[model samples]
Target: MSDDQAPSTENGGGGDVETVEKSEDHKKLVDFGLDTTVADELEKLFQAKLVTYDDLDPRALEAIRDFPIECAIAVLKQLLADSNLQHVNNKSAYICGVMKTYRQKQSLGEDKPAVTNGPDEKKLKEILDRTGYALEITTGQRKYGGPPPSWDGGPPGNGHECFVGRIPKTVYEDDLIPVFEKFGTIWDLRLMMNPMQGCNRGYAFVTFTTAEAAREAAKQLNNYEIKPNKKLQVNVSIANVRLFVGNIPKNKSREDILEEFKKLTEGLREVIVYAFPDDPKKKNRGFAFLEYDTHKSASGAKRKLASGRIRVWGSEIIVDWADPQDEPDEETMAKVKVLYVRNLRSNVTEEELKKIFEPFGEIERVKKVKDYGFVHYKERDSTLSALEAMNGYKLHEVEINVTLAKPANENKARERRMRRERDNNMNMGYDDYYSSYPPASFGPPPPMMRGRIARGGMRGRGGMMRPPAPMDYYDDYSGYGQGYGYDDYSSYGGCYEDFSAEYSPHPVTPQPPHRGRGRGGHHAPAPVAWTSNAAAAWPPWYAQRSGGYGTAWRGQSWHQ
Candidate 1:
C-alpha cells in the first residue's frame, strides 16, 4: 500500500471517510500498547463483527503483545483456522501469508534470515511483553503460555531483593510467583501472612536472581496494578539497624524526637514514636523505635546515649539495642490487669472507691491509701475496657488520673511507704501529741466576798453569789418631785420637750422623730409608736437626758 493509503489511524478514521471518534475506548486500547493503525483496524473489525470484540480486550492485547510479529501472525492464523474462516477477507492476510511462507520454507530445510519488520511491528511486540501477556504460536494454538520468562535460566536473588507492599489479601504464593516471574527469576518469594488468619497480610518479599533484574522490576512495577483495585509497591530491601528508645516524653512528636536525636548523631533512617492507636490525634506513648542505615551507627548511638544522658523535651531518654522479636512480648505486657488511680480525694473511703471501680469489672481487691491507690481486676480484658472507659473520669469531685499500673517493685513500695508517712504527718494534730491544761497562773485567785454584802447575803441557791436586786430608781426619784416621776415623763410623751423653747426665738421642731436605720444602712421613717416604745426600752440614765445625744456622749452611751 502507498504511504498515503497506508492508514490514518490517528483519529480512528480510514479511507477518507471521517468517523465519530470514541476517544476514550481508543485511549484504552492505546494504553494497552496497541498501535494507532492496528487499534483503528481492530475497532473497524469489531464493529463489523468480523472478530469478536472481546478478542481485542486489554487481556487479549496483553497476551498478543508478548509474541514477536512472526509468532503473533502465526497465532492469528491458528485462530482463523479454528474459526473455520481461514479465507476470510481481511487486511491482516498479507502478514499472515508472509509468516506462513517463511515457516514452510524453514520446514523444507531452507535457511533464511528472520524477517525485518517495521517499527510499528517492533513497537507492538514490546507493548505485549510489558503488559505481561504470553502467547505460544509455534504449536498451532492461540493459548496463553503464562507470563513471559523473567530470565532465561536460574533462580532470582543473586544479589538483590525487593519489598512489595499493598499486595491484595487474596493473592497467594502461586499467584505471585507466576506474575513476578515475568520480571526476573525469583529465588525466594514470601507473601507475608497473618499468623492467626493464615492469609496474606498485604505485603510480600521478592528476591531476584540478579541485581539488574531486581532494579528493573522495582522501577517498572512500582505502583503497577497487579489486580483490580490493587497496585504493587516495589522498593529496594535494605538491612536496617533498629534501636530501642525508652522514657520518651509523651508530649514529644516523632519529628521533634528525630530532630533532637539527629543533633546528637547522624544517619537516621526512620524514627517511629508509638501512639495511642484509637486516638484521632495519635498522642505519643512515651517510647519509640528508631532505624539506622548501619549497625555501627546504631551501636554508636546506643553506646553514647544509653547512659540516659540524651535528653528529649527536657527528659532523659533510655537507649538500647532493639530486638524485633521482643515486640510481641511488649504487647503482651500491655495486657496487665492492674490499674493505678491517682488524684483521689484524701477523704474518699474504700467503699466509695470500690463503687467507682466496680462498674468496670469484678474487683479482687482495692489497695487504697490516702489520695492514690491500685485496683486489681479479675481479668486483663476488663482492665483494658475500664481503662478506655474511665480514663480522665471525674470521681469525688476530682478528675482522677487512671492508667495501667506498672508491675510493683521494691523501689515503688518504698516510695509508697514514704508518701504514706508524709500524709500521716500532714493529718496529725497538736492534740494527738500533748494534753491540755490551764495556762500557768500569774497570781492567786481573788479573796471571797465579805459578810453581809447585800440583802441576799454573800451566797444564794447553788452556793453561787447573787448581786443585790436592782434598786428602785423610779421609786427613789418619785419622792424627789411629782414632775420627776416616771409616769410624769410618760405623760410628756417620753421625748423631752424643748424646755428652753422660750429662750429661743423660734420653738424647736422637736427634731424629726428619730428614724431607724433601714436595710443597707439608709435611714427610714420610724413609726409614731416605735419612738415611745424605743424610749421606754432605754436605760434609766438615758431617759433623763435632754436634747439630741452628742458625739462624745454617744461613745459614753455605748460603753455603758
Candidate 2:
C-alpha cells in the first residue's frame, strides 16, 4: 500500500511485524522520536484526526479567559496537527496553543474556515460539542474596577471596556508593548490625543485575539512597570474609534493577520481585531477593520499602496478601510409649554418625581415645588405621564387637583386688587357704624306749685290755715326720714323744700351683725338734714372734724 494508506506503527499497533510479541513486551508500541520528528508525526496524525484534553497549562489557559471554549479547542487542534507531536501531551499542547491563539486573535482577529469541516471548523465544532468549559470577560482601569461586556461566542473586542485615563503614544508603543507582550499579543493600541491639549488624557484602547490573552495582558501588565515610568496602566478599553471591524474568521485564528501586517509597518504598536456575530459556527467571511493609535497611522495606511489586493492566510482577503468622519452637530433643547402644579404632598421630592416619568423619555430637568407644589418635569412627556399616573391620586389623605399654573404677572395683579378692596370695605364699615349712633339727651321739668296754692277759685281750710297732720303720716314722715327729729317742710309751707328743712332721706343698705359683740343693742341710724346753703356754710375744719362733734358745731353755729 502507499505511504498514505499504510498503517504506521503509531496507531496502538505494530503492523506487519515478523513475530508477534506479548502485550508486556511491546508496552510502548509507538517509539517517540526527537522533538522535531515527534512534532511532524503529530502534525500528520492531526491532519487525520484531532485530540482533546481537560487539563491545560495554567498561564496559557488563563490567557484566553474571556475566549470561547471552541476557540481554545481550535487552538489546541492547530498545535496537535502533527503526528509526532501527539506525545507532547494533550494538556501541555492545549495550554500553549490557547496562549498563542489568544495573542494572535487579539492583533489579527478571528479566522474563518475556507472549507466545510476544515481544520479550523473541525476544531471549533469539537470544542462547541465538548462539555465543561466556561468563559469570563472584564475591562476598564486597574485603579477603578472595569466593566467587561459579556458575550456568547468568542470574546468580543476590548473596545467596550471603561477607560478613565490616557498615556503618551511613544510610551504606549515602545515602553508599554514590551511589558504587555509577555502576557499576549496586543492587537491594537489607541491613545486619544485631544486637539486642544496635546498631552495624553490618561487612557488607551487595547485589543487581544483571545479573551484569555486579553485577560492575561490585563492582569500582568495592567499595573506593570515600564522604564523611565513607574508602571504601564493597561486594561481592556472601550471602543473610542469611529470605525470598527466585522466578519472575523470562525477558527478563532489571529496569527495569519499579524504576519500579514508585519510587512506593512516596522513596529505597529497594536491593532484591535474582533469578531462580529454571523452565526453560532463562527464562520467569519474574512474581513475586519484595523484601528490605529492616531489619525496619522490611519492616514498613513490610507496613503500606502494596496498592491491592488489584500492577502490573508495565504488567501486573497478583503479589506474595509475607515476614514475619520466629522461628528454630527448637536441639536438645541426645545422650549415647551409647562403647567405649574401646587398642593402636592409634603414628602414629594424632585428626584422621586423624576423617577416616576423617566420611562417615557429623557427628562431635561425637574423642579419640585418648594411650597408643597407638585413637581414639574422639564419635558412634556413626563408631565403627561404624571397627569395620567397621579391625577386624583390620594396623598396624605388628601386628593390632589391638577391645573395650569397662572402667569406670575396675572397672579400679582389679582392679589393687589383683592387687598385694596378689603382695605376700603374695612374703612367704610367703620365710618358708617359711627354715623348710625347718636349722643344721649336729657331736660329739666317745669317748676312746681307751692304747697298751699288753690287749684280752683278758693283754697281748702287746711291749706288756708296750717296743714293738719298728713293722712299717710308714716309714709310722709318716712319719705322725709321719720326715725330722726325731722320737721315736715311741706307742712311748714314752701314751694320748694324750706331753707330750714328738717331732714334728707337716704337709702339704707342692709348690714351684717357683728358676731363678736356680746348682746349688743343695734343703734337706729339718725336722719341726715340738709339746710339751705349748708354745704357752702361748712366750717374750714370740715375736712378734719367729721363725727357727732361736727354736727353739734353746725347746730351751735346756726344758733349763733
Candidate 3:
C-alpha cells in the first residue's frame, strides 16, 4: 500500500486497522491532529444519534485546541459525566455548563484537579475576563463615600447620583424606590414635597449605591413615563448652591447686579433681579436671585455680604436671604387704569391728546400740563391695551413716554410743574407769535400825493401850495365883467347877453374881448376862436376860459 493508505500504530494496536474513508468535515477534525481513536469515538456517537458533528459547540472545540488529544478527550468526557449522559445531547449547552463550573470553582478558590497536561487556571481566568463576566471576580463590593469617583466614564451607581425632574406629583418615595431598585441597590431617594399641599413637588433626587446603577437607571428611566401623561426627566444631580439676594438697589440693572456679585467671587452661573411691573422707567425692585456651580462659592458670598451693606446709587442697600415663597403684594403690583405720559410737546392740547388715546379706550379724563399729561381710563383692560399700543408712540412729531401711573407725590408734582414752566419760558421765544388784531389792518400807511411846479412858479393843483382863487369863485352866473375876475366876456356878443340879462336884469354894451396878466404873470384868459357850437356845448369852465362870462375857476387847469 502507498504511504497515504498505510495504517499507523499510533493507537498502540497490532490488529489489522480498517481504513475508514473520512468526509470533508471529518478530514478537518483529523487535520487538527485529533487522535484517530477519539475521532472514531466521536463518529460512533454521531451514528448513535447521541450527538452530531454540527451539534458540537465551536467554542468548546476552540477552548480545548491547545490541549493534547488525550487531554481534550478527557475534558469532553468530564462535561458528559457532569451532564449525566454518555454523550452530550446539546454540545453548546454542555460547553456553557463547563464554563459555569470553571467560574464557580475559580470564584471559590477551589483547587480542582486539572484535566489537561498542565494547570489551566490562568487560561480559564483569561476567558472569563475577556467575556466581561469577571466583574464579580475583581471588586467584591462597591466602596461608599467621598465625592463619588469622577463620573466621566464611570457607570451609573458607581459613584454618582441622578436628579429626576418632571415626576408626577402623586408619586411617593415607596413607588419610586422600587422601580429604580431593579437597576441596582438604592442608597437614598428624596422626593421634594410641598409643605401646604403635602404632595410631591414634581421632582426628586435619587442616589444609587454605585455609579453603574445610577447610569443604567438614568439611561432607561430618563423621559420614562411614570404616569399616563407625565414623564420623568433624569439627569446627573448638580450641587445645590442657588442663593436669594434681597435689598438690591432699585436703580441697579441685571448686568450691574451680576457685576456686583462677581466681585465677591467667581463662577456665578446666573443672576436675576426682579423689576417693577409695567414700569415705564424700567427700574428694578430691591431684590435678586443668584446661582453658583458649587455650594462653596454661594455660601461664601452670603457670609461676606449678608452682614454688611452695599452702597448703590447713593443709597445703602440691605442684603438678606430671599424666601422663594415671598412675592410682591397685589396692591403694589401694576394695574392698568391710569397712564402717565411724559415728554409731551408744549403745544399738544388736551383735545389733540384725547384723539390720540381715545382709540385705545374711553378716556375718563385727561389732565395736561405743559410737557406732560395723565390719561385716566374707564377700564383696566383698556388701560393695558392703550399702554401697549401707545407706549413709544409718536405724537406731535415727538415720541411720548407712556407708562402705568403711580400715586402722585406732592413734591414730585410741584417739581414737575416748575420744570414745565421753566421749559415753557425757554422755548416760548422760538414759537411763532400770534396777534389779536386782523393781519390786514397792521400795515404801513397809504402813500402821499406828489406834484410838479408849473413854469410860472405856480404849484400844480395837487401840490402843497394853495391856489389864488377859491373852488367856488365862479359861483355866480353873472357876465364876466360884472365881476369875479375875467373882464373879456363882452366881446363874445350875445353869448354873455343871455347870462347878463338873467342875473343882472340889464344888457351891457358888447365890447371886444380883452386879455390880462394876473399876479404870477400868467395870463388870466387866452383868446380863442369861438363858435356857436362851442357856446352851446361848452361847460361853465370852458365858457369862462373862452371869455364868455363868469369868474376864473380853480380846479385842475384845463387845456384847450
Candidate 4:
C-alpha cells in the first residue's frame, strides 16, 4: 500500500490498544509536487459525492477522465510531495467552502431560476416543499365525505386529471377513465356527484403517479371536445376556484340554470341553481352560486354579466354594489365670531396684544376690560394669531390658553343680570323710606277718644270763645257771608263772586279736546276735523271703481 494508505503504529501492542487513527479527510497544502494522475482521481471522487472544488472547474477536470486510476494516483502522490502544495490546496479548500455555501443558498430558492421546461417529479416536489405549496387533494363531492356513486376503487397517486363540473357522475367516470389512462398510471379517479341527485354531475378529480404525466394529460386534454352524443369539454385542474351564487332568476332549474351560465362562461367549472332544502318549491332562491376553476373564466363571467347577461323570470337578477368599508364624509359650514378672553394681567392691555397679532390678520377691534381683567378681540384671525404666538409664551408667569371666543350673547346676558341686581337694590332702599310714618302737617289724632268728653268740649266752644284770627287769614276779605257757616273773607272788602269763581261752587263745563297737541296725541286728528271727517266718510264706499273705499284706504288713497 502507498504512504497515503499506510497503517499507523501509533497504537501499542495488541492488548486492546488505544489507537490514534489518522483522519482520512482531504487537506490543503501550500505546495504540492507534480502528480497529475492522483489529483485527477481525487477530483473525480469529490465530484461523484457532489462535493465541489472551488478553485478548479469540474468541466476542466473532464479531460483527465480516460486516464487510468494507477496513473491518476501516481500524479496525486507526486503533487503531494511538494512543500508549496499545502498553500495552494489551502486556497483551494477556502474557495470550495464558499462554493458549497453558494450551492446550499441556491437550494433555498431565494433567487429561483425560471422553470421554462416543465420540472420533473423530484423538481416539482422540491419546488413545492420550498414554496409551501400543497397538492390540494380532494374527493369527489359537493361537500366533503360523500363518495362517488360509481366508485371503481383506484389506487393512490393515479395519474389522472380532477375537476368540478355539471356533467353526470356516471358519464364523467365512464368517459374520463379510458381517456385519462392514456398518459400514465391512473392511481386514483373520482367523479364528483351530488348525494341527493344520485348521478354524475359532469365533474371529476384524478391523481397521477408522476407530475410529468399529469402535465402531459393537462396539455393534451384541455379544451379538447369529446363527442359522445353531446360534446364534452376538458381542462386542467386549476385550483383558483371562485364559488359564488348570487343574482339568479327565480324561475330557473338546475339543468336550465347550468345551460344559461355555460353559455355565459367558456370554461364553466360549475353552475348550481338549487333552492334551499327548506324551500324546494321556491324559485331558484332568487340567486345561484357559481364556482369557476380559473380566474380567467370567472373574470369572463363578470364581463358577460356586464354586457347584459341577466335573465328575468319572476324577478330580474341583480349584482349588488359592495358595501363601503369607510363611512361617508359629513360636511359642515364654518362660522366666524368675536372672542373675549379673561384672566390676563391688567398690565398686559389690549393695544399691546393687538400689535403682537397685527401681522397675522386685520385687527378689527381690541379693547381692554380692566373690570374683569381681560382683552377682547373682535376679529377671529387676530385671536388665532395671538393664540399661536403667545400661547406658549410666558405672560404673567403663566402660559396663555388661546382659542376662539365664546358667543357675545352669553356675555350680554351676564351683564344684563348684573345691572338688574343693582337697580333692584336701589328700588328696595327707596321703598323702605317712602313707606314710613306721615309728616307733622297731617296732625296727630286728638287725645284719643277715651277722652271723648274733652273732644266734645273743644268742638262746641267755637268762634265766640276763640281768640281773634291772625292777619295772615283773609277769609272775611271776600263779600261772602261772615256767619258761623260762611267764609270769613266776606268780613273784608273782597268780593264773594271772585272767591266763588276760584273755588268753583257751580258745576264747571267740560273742556273741549286740545287743538294744541303734544307728543302724547300729536298724530290724532283735531276735534273739529274729526267730527267733519266722521260725518263725511263713515262706512263710505268708493265714488269711482278705481278710487279708494272706506277703511281699506288707510294713510293713502288707492287712487294715489
Model 1, 1-560: lDDT tens per residue? Answer: 54322434343224555442343454566567765555554455454554654434454566545435445544443333333222233324423433454456557774342322111334435544664544322212122222235535433321256677787766654455556678865555555544223245577667666666666777788898878878888855532256656567667777887888888876666775434323325445455667665545767787778655666667666554442110111343466676766555667777877887898889976655334556778998888888888878877555666666544223323433343345334543324311221122222112333331211111110111211111222211111111101111111111111111112223222112111110000011110111101111111122112111111111111111
User: In candidate 2, residue 503 scores what lDDT?
Assistant: 24
- Expressed as tens digits, the lDDT of each residue in 419-459 for candidate 4 is 33443345343224323312212111223233212321122
Cα-based lDDT at residue 323, candidate 1? 27
Leading candidate by TM-score: 3
Candidate 1 RMSD computed on C-alpha atoms after optimal superposition onto the true structure = 42.2
Cα lDDT tens digits for candidate 3, 1-560 = 55433443323247665444344445555666666655644544454555567876666455545445554454454433332232224565554444444445546774242231111345434533443221110011111212323334322321246677786655654356557768975555555544223245567666675766776887798888888977887755433344645445567787887887788666576775434333435445454557664445666766666544645455544332321111112353254376766556667888988898998879977755334566878988888898889978877656666666543223323433343344335433211211211122211112222321232222211212212221121111111121101222211111111111112223323222211111111112211111111111111222222111223422223222
Q: TM-score, each model?
A: 0.20, 0.17, 0.22, 0.17
Instruction: Give a tens-digit lDDT track for model 2, residues 1-560.
Output: 44333333432245653212212111211222113223233334334444322233445334544445455434434444421232134444434543453455545664521111111334423432442222111111111011222323432432223222335433423344345446544444444432112233455555454556655565566555554565555544333221222223445444554555657633333443322222324322233334454334544553442433544444433232332211111111122223333334557676765675466556654444221233334666655666566656654444444333222122323432343344334534323432332321121111223321231111101111221112222211211211111122111100011111122133322222211100101111111112110001111121111111112211111110
Q: In model 3, which runs have C-alpha deviations exceeding 4 angstroms?
A: 1-240, 309-316, 322-560
Alpha carbon lDDT at 28, candidate 3: 52
Worst 10 residues of 2 by lDDT: 516-525
- The whole-model C-alpha lDDT of candidate 3 against the native structure comes to 0.44
Clash statistics: count for each candidate: 6, 36, 15, 57
Better of 1 and 2 by TM-score: 1
